[model samples]
Target: MKANQPMVKVISSGKYAPSTLITNEDLERLVDTSDEWIVTRTGIKTRHRAVDETTSDMAYKAAMEAINRVNYDKDKIDLIIMATITGDQMTPATANFVQAKLGLNHEVMSFDINAACTGFVYALETAASLLQTGRFRAALVIGGEQLTKIVDYTDRNTCVLFGDGAGAMILEPSTHERNQAFFFNAARGDTNNTLTVVNHIKMDGKRVYLFAIDAMEQAIRKVLESSGLAIEDIDVIIPHQANERIIQSVSKSMGIPMDKFMLNLSEYGNTSAASIPITIAEYYDQNEVKNKKILLVAFGGGFTWGSAILQL
Candidate 1:
């Protein structure tokens, strides 16, 4: 069999959501919003809040679970790529903190990437590519965020739409044809600043909605085409849990069924970079996933969007 460019197999997966819950009813007190309105609009009922935890904390917790699930040797993880907008600090990359928490005192290639909500897809592609180089054996890919720290409670539109959590996957290069991976990551710059997170998150909801639908559709189609796989070939699609409406629109437009997409935004709202991996971890937890071909798609703040097709 021919070797693929981005070929990495998942050894284990895990996720960490803070215990604290922020329900729509709780948001009604913070801003001018109702449970019915929030649910009808975003399909989100509640989101997790990391009260005392930082992004790196959630990342470490999630990574530990993934490692322990298979009892994988910590030394095998020679590469660590974390995708997040919120880090514990400015200088030390969040991946560094996660590497420390994982107790890897040895030299490991670790770093962080911020492509916003589509970050996990970007990081997955990066790690997969790096693993193919034969320099790294196993890679820890994580998507984590503490979005609430950067959200403004006064803004009803953005405030109710984010949460805090982390998800991780342990991957290693695989020569097996079944484990071949394909990805497409691209971005359209937000010149108008349709969505921006400087001190806090600010967004034009209408513009983002329109862009998300188009971007997600493009990514899904591109990855499928590049992988030579049709929609039916995919067992499930793990889309960014940003909005149920956006997923629904993509489903309807693409002639794909809604049930084919894994959704958990009702329990955890847009976790920024963490959404896709969290959905992937939760999906694996609920189902028997083996040799399953999955498609991941996401659209984010950089006007960034990407997709990946891989087998489990």
Candidate 2:
């Protein structure tokens, strides 16, 4: 590795989902939806729900798992960046609560970012930028959401589309030749009320679907272009586990094979910020990603969307 090259590499990843499983059949009792309808449209059969667990609790669990994966030194972690739309509290940042729960006594910079489903990608980019400054050695980037808390169960449209979960990752300076990661994040303020969560989750399903497809395609192309890499060069693409239809559309539009995308929404639902990182953690746990190039793309409610290319 060159001495002047500043590279932020992911060291480990972890994820946590609640024990309570809400199956499509279960939704039939609460709403007017059926297993066949949801399965055919969203590819979701079941989703985990946080009955009593807070967002910070899930975040802490995921973070601990990532730290334990490598027996990482907690003292070396100087930063914690958590991404979520449904935090435990509105006063102190959710990251602060996680830091405390982890028993970190050091003075670490802990904060939270809210970009809805695209939050994990935004947080990853932010952590990489701060790590490249050469001041922080290791940092924890987490995405946790108790999204079921905000979903209006009375409305079948939004109710069937969300769940609760968390995922985390540890990042450190890299010495490998191909350890750098590239990112492209952009968002347009939502004025049309296509997607919003004021009193409860509300969205124009058709409008949001159109926006998601376009955003994913553009974000993927932008990141690959910036990294000077071709589509075939990517080993895996982990997109936000929003809807199966969006992923299918992007696959068709980009001429990319569906096998290249890591998908688990069928089991976890739309976990918002937690989706991509959770998918990543599960993928790394199941596959050999030692020197692979992974692409991540996400689109969410703030009209937020982003893409990232990371070399493992």
Candidate 3:
């Protein structure tokens, strides 16, 4: 609502998951877990596996789909932000590889953000701030992850909870007054290593579950209060696809109906940063989202958590 603040709008979105499907039955062959157990605990029946695809490969595919959705001029896109913990290389940022694959000839500000599951929300807030300066016209914000590569198939605890996928959205300056977006991001340094991925995805499930519920409630309340909107005013909520219990807990605690939340973790498990955008893109593909109020929230490793509200 500041006089000089520019409004940012999402022009289009796209999502992509690997062709390989790993059902709970497939997991039974590798780990000592059952379909009923996985479903009862995590609500994950199946997830996608990236056979030979790199993080950048999926990111590029997702970006192209988003770009093509609006016939956006790639030449005019001045910024590219990719959110992922699983990069093909540890040196150059994954955003650089995505730019090259997209065949963008001009110089643009390209970088990667690693906030774990909250990465996409962080990237969106960062891009929106830059665009608000009127220096950047358009930005391609992508969240992609190949978690299956790092997952320990033998460890049933973390193995069945991750999948591979990518999602992308184009952000541009908006003229509509109601199209403005608001964001709230926060983080906690996990010195105790409650959740981390140094060698592989290792987490204390009980600790993470407790943290997730608190973070979700705090973020949702903070965004709603800051935006001067109530829970009833929001149309849809796209939360990180981590666990079914975490979301259900938050819903019960907040007294919100589960139907208001968009979820695809049952099919894709937790794709980390890719969850929210992937769900949003897929939902938009099937439903009309124009001028509707949307809320996005996530909690991830690094103890990072955040929420964003925007109109599509």
Candidate 4:
């Protein structure tokens, strides 16, 4: 007894960052840890630090990139949904600030979704659903995080695992694409225990590792069933870049080669919610996502996880 159109897809994507580099070497200065140790544990060599850059700055940078890539007029966008927990302030949604800084006209709706690390994928699903109704012509899905602000640099366990940056995707209605075919779902494991400060990027590395593989494995299967497609039919997997080991395990268990997946976690650590979007932006910069069956799977705070499958 359901009636509707079909699925949605991403047309163009962009990413941006500050020039400041916060390397593992720098971490040694603020915390009791060495670059070698950090890399050995997290596969992260360096991460960007806004330093003096605000969250709006990163969001703006990303938004401009997507605008250029999509060749979209700011006045033409239908909605702007930023996937982030690190909004620049408590008031106006970071999406609005980003919208203003990007000089986007008010023809679109703008807001933020805070699913921590799962932000980008969740934002995509949200914006896609909005477009499925035929009301939205274009959507700006962005993910930006300034984790360096809340990070206790002295806390080795947490400080070593985050970076700063932003990513944006221009989602437009694909005339040939069917919204009824897109599949999306999110599952929660156990992070309800820390939902209070859910927007603050809380994490237990070991616990996340254990839950990530299992949760991602589950999320992947759910979308596969929903989309009526097989994993082998998917061209590339864009996973939340939280850790090398976790990504590796999921790829292995799914029988998907490492090359079939994207990896930027080695350099960014866990950029909290910004991981997936930033990775997608970087990958597309290299012209990787063309004419492919795309899969986005992510897991994060709230112990939540989900997957999205679309043809691009």
Best by lDDT: 1
> For each candidate, how many residue pairs have backbone atoms clashing (under 3 Å)?
0, 0, 0, 8
Model 3, runs deviating above 4 Å: 2-6
Estimate candidate 4's alpha-carbon lDDT, on a 0 to 1 scale.
Answer: 0.78
Residue pairs whose backbone atoms clash in candidate 4: 6-178, 6-179, 6-180, 7-178, 7-179, 7-180, 116-273, 117-273
lDDT of 3 by residue, 1-312 (tens): 634434798899999999999999999999999999999999999999998899999999999899888888888888999999998889699999999999988888999999999999999999988998878889999999999988988888999899999999999987777877888999989898998887788989999999999999999999898888898999999999999999999999999999999888999999999999899898889798887889999999999999999888
lDDT of 4 at 100: 84
How well is each residue in 1-312 modelled by candidate 1, as lDDT tens digits? 333557789899999999999999999999999999999999999999999898999999999888787888989889999999999988699999999998999889999999999999999999999999989989999999999999999999999999999999999998877788989999977899999989999999999999999999999999888888889999999999988999999999999999999999999999999999899999888999887888999999988999998788
lDDT of 1 at 35: 97
lDDT of all predictions, in order shown? 0.93, 0.92, 0.92, 0.78
Candidate 2 lDDT tens digits, 156-201: 9989989999999999976566897888999999899899988799
Worst 10 residues of 3 by lDDT: 1-10
Q: How should the candidates be ordered by lDDT, best one leading?
A: 1, 3, 2, 4
Where does the lowest 10-residue lDDT sum fall in candidate 4?
Answer: 191-200
What TM value does model 1 have?
A: 0.98
Provide the clash count, candidate 1: 0
- State the TM-score for model 4: 0.91
| Candidate 4 residue-wise lDDT, 207-294, digit = tens | 7788889988988898887766787888888888877888888888988799988888777767766777787887777765667777
